[model samples]
Target chain A: MNSTPNEQVPLADNSIIDLQEVSIFYSGKIAVDKVSFPIAKNKITSIIGPSGCGKSTLLRSLNRMNDFIPGVTVDGMVTYGGQNLHGSEVDPVEVRRCIGMVFQKPNPFPKSIYKNVAWGPGINGYKDSMDELVEQSLRQAALWEEVKDRLHESALSLSGGQQQRLCIARALAMAPDVLLMDEPCSALDPISTAHIEDLLFELKSRYTIVIVTHNMQQAARISDHTAFLETGKLIEFGVTDQIFTRPQNQRTEEYVTGRFG
Target chain B: MTTDTYQAVQASNINKRSTRWAEFLIQSGLGLCALVSIITTIAIIIILGKEGFSFFQHVSPAEFFLGTRWVPLLEPQSFGVLPLVWGTLLVTFGAAVIAIPIGLASAIYLSEYASDRVRSIVKPILELLAGIPTVVYGFFALTFITPLLKGIFPDIQVFNALSGAIVVGIMVLPMIATLSDNALSAVPQTLRQGAYALGATSYEVTTQVVVPAGLSGVMASFLLAISRAIGETMAVTLAAGATPNISLTFFESIQTMTAYIVQISLGDAPAGGIAYQTLFVVAGLLFVITLILNVLSQKILMRYQEVYD
Candidate 1:
């Protein structure tokens, strides 16, 4: 764990989540090699990698979403605020509640727009004004302006981008501490991707965000810190500007430059 | 041109012609199969219509429909179809009450919780249950179920609607279970993942998200099972007596529509007589009832269908 000059910076003090040599295996096949990185509090950290490089595996491990898969196993420690996430006593359900996720494809429930936003909170026993909470969440996700008049309409009625935003709002209703995005913009158009990227910038100030992306420029544009992965191995971890401008590892340079991935 | 290239070109042309012929053959085969089914249905409807009209002429429509009794063979024959209709409805209703809950529960378990090995085994076993002959089920109902119920309740009749209903319920269980399992499994994996990511328990994900999304298919399965129960003949005829009584008690013996048809056809009635014509009339009524139910159920399903595509 030797610290490089960039790693020596005081930003490490702001780390809200710490992964210590975390490795994941599915049915005895390694999907993520021992990967270690710090996620800064209230900042966007992006993991960029080619397809099948285990970037998504690493992101899903943070909230124990991999537990749902058969024969999945994890080694090493992932700690959030001094609590081990994969510890024997840790409840995966509680981990998911505190760490909400948006999927690659928009998966808003086949329900009304209002119910989609209110469902998580409703199930978790939110006793306050549900209408106010739903409105606030949609407003935060930047979807309220277009759908405010038809809150009771089915979420499937919305456009793909709107539905993605509605999914984000659904997660926001849970009031999580961390938000995980697994290529949330891959299914969207450029304009919708830009809308989501902008929304990420606004959201990071309130929630610690970790995003996995195949798009190098997106990682550069929206992330404060970047971690590049190649073939289940972490190639380099540093500040986004440094990683994009002056990557130390040859593989990182090759991947970020689009010469090879 | 080289000889190899010339031969390759000729071979490709021959292959393309054969492929076109194969495609045309398949299309014609499928079309013929569909046409056969259509023609059979038309022939049945025409025969039923002619015979049903003749029966209505012998007995007034009001007496046939509103009559409270159904003795068409003895002196002063009463052709009131109310008792028969009531019996058919009671048996169908009783079967539904038994099947829906048990079938749906098994479907959820098989689709959501069963391991792949367990599913591969159990699913075929359910299909085998469907493959059982209806006559065998009738014998089992008469011998096993009736005697068992008699032990539990001394007042239980040997030939009662309850026994027929239970056997028919068992007969239709495989239909409901298999179709419902298909519906549940057809729910996209993404929806389940979305609910789990939102911290929903497996129960919550299944009952709330998966079931609601697959409701249209589930409802269709229920309707199909109901129709099968209504049209069941051999088991109801053997287990339930041939008396068409309008009593509400399920313990009493009753004759369903199919059973009545069986009774008259087995008797020594003259050809083209009122007794003979009653078979076609009752069959037509059954057909119209089932057709209306199917159409209404389809309309209900379409209203709630969530098109994932």
Candidate 2:
């Protein structure tokens, strides 16, 4: 059921990030009202909502990606490792270093496949073998075997599915503690979406993941926890099975049953 | 079929026929406009070839191309075109040295760092530099920049390659900045976001991702500006003296291919003589050089576009 705006959702002890009464505004217009939730460590958490429901806005705030937007203001707190992410002392660049992201569309740099994977660690002064890192990251994203022979080829030469996986590999190269995905499979075909969904499931074992998806079935299939949102407010937060099978709120049930968005 | 339906179909067909006719007429009109430019270019090439062939008949191709000394007007006329080519290249290179780094840096600032408000206010002022007449820039070079250089070198000549180079750089700077800014700005926002999401700082994102992604555009702008500098006449004619000497230092006077063309076209050279025919030959060479640069720029642009698209 929907909790009070100021009340914190009870989270597991293994929670890695906690949002407390977070509200986001763009040009003084509220996009996400006061909402509180916890993202568990090494678990996949899916945020499900219809279009314009602040899912992406909330996800972007997790890694301070929202800082790039003009006139964007985040009230309340997003905490990671006991530090407020929005604290004046916390640098957004460093915040992104710890928590990486994948966008809705595949956005690979116009570089070779190897460089695309190595760029993150290289810029961060990885101080290790770049070749090894690129291989390991690609292997983790399940793209190494397909692109191993052509590591020096342009990343643009890859197919859409391969490009999206390359984006995942690029993010994985940073070796961040968490990965945020904003509808990472929205532009993909069903086969590619399934491929990415499987990749996310494997990635969750190593990195905590927060995904915003419009696909209810995807949330039910892979996520350990699911949060249903409507009109900038969290409608329900519970285990994925229970939310889909026996949603406590009427709107959640209606959305889950495909009766209405 | 119903009679009303048949009539409606006939009426629709008539409308489509009229629309097709109008579309054909408009398309042909546009085609004619395009053909006019193509025909003009061909005509220019034919005329240049005819005059250049006549000029080459008197002066051998090897002498014109390989000779180092170019004295066409005086009695002991030895026409080696290298000096003019060297002068043109020297000024173009100097202008490039001044403009490329400064122009690219400003483009990066405008595209990546500047806010929309700041960009709008600054870009127009930068482009205003391009609008000033080249004649005015020539005088500005003669009166302003030469004096400034003299203050530095003290022994610098009144009319020297340095002054011409500086003015030409200023003249072409706005082209590089505006075109490079457009190219940099055209880089998809998603690519920038991708780099930022990878924990790149703004500087790293600009240099590593955005700049590299937009490099073809920047290179194209550089080539175009270089070509423009090569073709510039009035500014170089006034600032760089008519001596036609090939020297390494910018402190000495020199004459570019464009300056020679201007000199001959000023009603001094007798018609139907070798001195006058040299004008067409030099102009032909300048045209070929610019054409090569333009073609190379377009090739780079097309190659990069394929990668991005």
Candidate 3:
């Protein structure tokens, strides 16, 4: 089943999700061309590329997030633990439950902080203590301490960074096995970005994390595995340290070394 | 070279002066345009107050408010506004019952489900409903809707509150649907994506996230549409049959406040007479009811306004 020509494809002990030669097209135009990479279980994988180079487009395909866009077409296969995500038998709603996403901007629902976390689990028919679930998810996203007292307050009242964390908590409440982030920290300040980076480092121990990031250093700082993409193609995929320090593809080296986008 | 610089500066100053003059002129013109509505409102208040206050002298406030009968021309005329108030309320309530579900469904369909092509084709047709004359709607209620109701309930009158209300509801449906659609569309796309990412089905997202986010706007639209229905004149007047009978039955002919004013004013009620005074008094009363509704709705809207940025 392994058809990629690259010999340096790093295989992990437990790969929870895999994109096998997946290409995405929006309205007959190719956004990501034949990009395949394995997202190892319980590890942070960061996809880095210049803007409009299809990093986000590729990341969105994992949970069938691109299905929301009209005229979007996905080629090849995205699989979660050997189950095809795009197969007719798989419901996108169920797929999204297993593989949740956090977007570029912090889009907390215009609701109370409590509702923001509880809504996901509540809608998905969580029969246990909703309050406990909400608090646990918030704590997991590193937001409970700051937001515990004002749980009923509007989520919009929180700061930009806090809102981003709340969004993460909202995603976590669904108890997803894998979390896909589309430049989640791109809209935050440097301090907020660092907090999220640290949170991601801690989160990888439990949930498989794949993030598309524009910041090269942030990717290097937090990600265990890094996938560098250029012009809709996967330039290189390897351990973060190796990709940053050594040379494989000239483009990946150039992109990581501050030489070229 | 210095003279050339001086000439350029002088020319620039002249251009600046003209620009300032143009700006001042345009600013004042815009200000005056805004003031037109304010001035008109003031004038209406003055006119209605003068005549409305005169009516109070002829009839005591307690009698006008508490009394249920509203006959101005008869010898034993009673001018209690309760019957008119009940009539207005009944028609408005009936209209709301018919309008809210249909309007919101159309709004949701237009906003969440419709493609660009479908939206383009459907939106103008809805707007066309708004453009149809209220008089035409009145005739529609009288000629078409009343007969249809007569079929359902054999006891229904030729001119009845139900028919008037149903037609008014149809008349205001465009407003509710259009404004509600705008409100729903105003909800950001990212929020919908965020909900979808949380494994919510399209139905859940529409009902929970997108709808709640745009709730204030939808509520505001509903309030505005209700106000329009309350203030509706011609349709209610023609279909409801201006008998001023204060019955609770929907099939019974009743007279709304607007209909009362029209009936009295058109019948050549002498100027400054008790009958003529009823017109201003009822108009003033109608004005107060709608103003309170608008104010309360605005306050609620402001309180729940969800700023997504």
Candidate 4:
């Protein structure tokens, strides 16, 4: 199992992910229309858009999340590690195991905090030193400090913000290659938002991260690269500072300024 | 002068109206129906106590508790409740064994697997099973179910606990299924979303999240179903024979407590006869059993309640 973090650059540079002419449709209604892009290895990609945009849909498609819904079909290619994701003989369960997702709302199981983090790793059968791994994952997510003493407490007892971070920690325990987060901090308060944003900054070095955010400031502050989407279409993609300071598309400009959130 | 006289007649008159406090008293009076309920309960207890005491005067309490022979009309007239109690337990256990799996599976399918149109169609049909007259259920048990069983098992007695248990299972299935469905459906959608987001298959989520969280509700429904089975009389009387055999075999004829009460009531015993008095004692026993179960169910539900949606 030869694995490299920087394998998604390009053919010359060995890009880890390649998307070509990919479109997502839900019963003839296009959710992501003809979007093609390459995600660099170990770099954070933030998708910013108003509500109803297909940022999350695009992120979910990358991992075959849309396969669960009936009448959802993807027309195009999504290459991960030089393999087509939607190809036959490809199990979505395997794909999910590799590319895990965290949702907008916190969804901690009605389980103990330690058990919550141990769940994915245990199911995937990561043998040896499980007790240590759970601790390490929680520490990495910055949840261990506050919840370290109460690892046996029900995950529901935590504040809303803590639960979301616990969710992040749980995903990390799965040991996925890419982490897809759909508005992870939109439901948290300001302090908790800053904490999660900082955690994201810390996480990008180890994992390829794709986050969908509604907060322009969050995108500007935390993202290395930002893609703006509108009504299931990619409007623009560029460096975060460049997208905020200068814009090529009117829709992108209108959205970033809080004109029509 | 005539007009002034008419004005004087109309003077110093105020329409009578009920005060707000009087209205409050009227509402409070309606609310005190709780008192009426308490009084009815006390009256029932008093009546049962008197009748049960009179039964003990004729039949010793030790004999009632331990004696196996239950010949109420024979020359010696040995009055023991153990046979009736054992019979009640046999049928109730049989009903529960049939009800639990089928009822829970139906609930799971309805809440988790079925589509809305199917649910809408299936729910009322299930409720219709509950709404069928107990007497009709009795007749169905006797005329249809018993003969059907006899076809399958050639030696099954025409009147046995199996047929009555099956009918009662169907009758109480709706209660358990509907209650459990409500509980399972009440589990927050977020918990499910969380499981899915964690890359869990739908089967995993259903087993891991939905089932455990809904367990308390399912247990409560089970207890309630047991209570209903204990209180059932007509179907058991018709389908299960009046032999008062303390047997566990479903293929053989048996007598439940309810059936014995019905049997006693249908026949004329002297005003203070031991058999006549046993009905109250049996009723007391049934009341105690149901009360304990209800309390246990409430305790589990209240103690481990998942408060947040």
Best by DockQ: 3
Interface RMSD of each: 0.6, 0.5, 0.5, 1.8
Docking class of 4: acceptable
How well is each residue in A1-261 modelled by candidate 4, as lDDT tens digits?
Answer: 012222232322434677788899899899888887777667777898878788888888888878767688898999997788999878777788888788898888888999899877776678979889988899889999999999999998999999999999999988888888989998999999999988987887788888899888888788767788888888887766667877888888988887887
TM-score of chain B of each: 0.89, 0.92, 0.91, 0.89
* B151 Cα displacement, candidate 1 (Å): 1.2
- List model 1 lDDT by residue over B13-83, tens digit each: 76443457888899999999999999999999999999999888889999999999898887788899999
**Candidate 4 - chain A - TM:** 0.92
Task: Give lDDT per model, in order.
Answer: 0.91, 0.91, 0.89, 0.83
* Cα DockQ of the candidate 4 complex: 0.39
Question: Compared with the true structure, what per-residue lDDT tens digits does model 4 show for residues B256-280?
Answer: 8888878878775665666677789
User: What TM-score does model 1 achieve against the real structure?
Assistant: 0.94
Instruction: Output the worst ten-in-a-row residue range by lDDT, candidate 1 chain B.
Output: B12-21
TM-score of 2: 0.95
Q: Looking at model 4 chain B, which ten-residue stretch has the lowest summed lDDT?
A: B9-18
TM-scores for candidates 1 onward, in order:
0.94, 0.95, 0.94, 0.87
lDDT of 2 by residue, B1-309 (tens): 999999998887754333578888999999999999999999999999999999999999999999999999888998999999999988999998998888888899999999999999999998899988999999999999999999999989998999999999989988999999999999999999999999999999999999999999999999999989999999998999887888999999999999999899998789989998999999999999999999999998888687666
Quick one: best lDDT, which candidate?
2
> Candidate 3 lDDT, tens digit per residue, A91-196?
9999999999999999999899999999989899999999999999999999999999999999999999999999999999998999999999989999998888
Mark the regions of model 4 whose C-alpha exceeds 4 Å error after superposition: A1-15, A18-22, A25-27, A67-75, A82-89, B1-42, B56-62, B303-305
Candidate 1, residues A42-150, lDDT tens digits: the string is 8889999889999999999999999878999999899987988999999989899999999999998888999999989988899999999999999999999999999
| Candidates arranged by lDDT, highest first | 2, 1, 3, 4
Candidate DockQ scores, in order: 0.76, 0.80, 0.87, 0.39
**Segments of candidate 1 deviating more than 4 angstroms:** A1-8, B1-33, B295-306
| Share of reference contacts found in each model | 0.63, 0.77, 0.91, 0.42
